[model samples]
Target: MTASSSIGTGPGRALIAVYGLFSLAAGARATVQIAGRFQEAPLAYSLSAFAALVYIVLTVALWRGARGLALVALGIELAGVLVIGTASLLDPAAFPDETVWSAYGKGYLFIPLVLPVVGLYWLLRRRR
Candidate 1:
């Protein structure tokens, strides 16, 4: 078996890399936003922090081959991006600034929109 087969059977190294990118990006963004000017956009910054937490959890779960936790985190992340994406688009005023999911992650090149789909696919494939 390959190194990937030694873990859960899915996308393997590629998925880990993607998850790592998200973990780093989200964590850094949240850390800066929450630390710098949280008072300016409390809700948005808080949501950013939450998104970072989810990303971190998702990354670790995937790395450890915890398919169940990965699925749960990815599902929650998908729902969050969708709901917040729509809300941000429909009600710009509701958000004083941007969150991780704002505008469907337009600021993040829509990766927020795409990552969950990939994650779900990997998770389902591993389930079989």
Candidate 2:
């Protein structure tokens, strides 16, 4: 019921940690891929970096207890996963390599697709 408790207690911590890991993983992968072979699949690489940014924003917002910002970031993440996943599945030419959302996060054990859902649910449950 209090302010900080909503963000500091319960499942929030687990969610925050997971998001943090995802941020690092995606960000590092994007940076390496973009720097190494950006020309190979510019769109896919760019999308990878964008997904990393979304994960970072969501992680920070949640850590700072910014409910609205977290929600918005998670919304973007979910949309990105859906759209990119669908596109990658339907057409492989545009994304020769793989972004975080490729195949609905098939490469990442589908965590990319599920994370946003969990994040959104956590935000909603914490919201009064």
lDDT of each: 0.82, 0.88
Each model's number of backbone clashes? Answer: 0, 0
Model 2 ranges off by over 4 Å: 1-5
Q: What TM-score does candidate 1 get on C-alpha atoms?
A: 0.89
Estimate, for each residue in 1-128, the C-alpha lDDT of model 2 and write its tens digit.
66644864588888888888988999999999999999899999999899989988877887888888888998999999999999999999989999999999999999999988988887887765
Instruction: Estimate TM-scores for all models.
Output: 0.89, 0.94
Span of ten consecutive residues with least summed lDDT in model 2: 1-10
Predicted model with the maximum TM-score: 2
Q: Return the lDDT, model 1, position 45.
A: 87
Q: Which residues of candidate 1, in runs, are more than 4 Å off?
A: 1-10
Clashing pairs in 1: none
lDDT string, candidate 1, 1-128, tens digits:
53324344446667777778877888898889889998888888888888988988887887877777887898999999999999998989889898889999989999999999988876676556
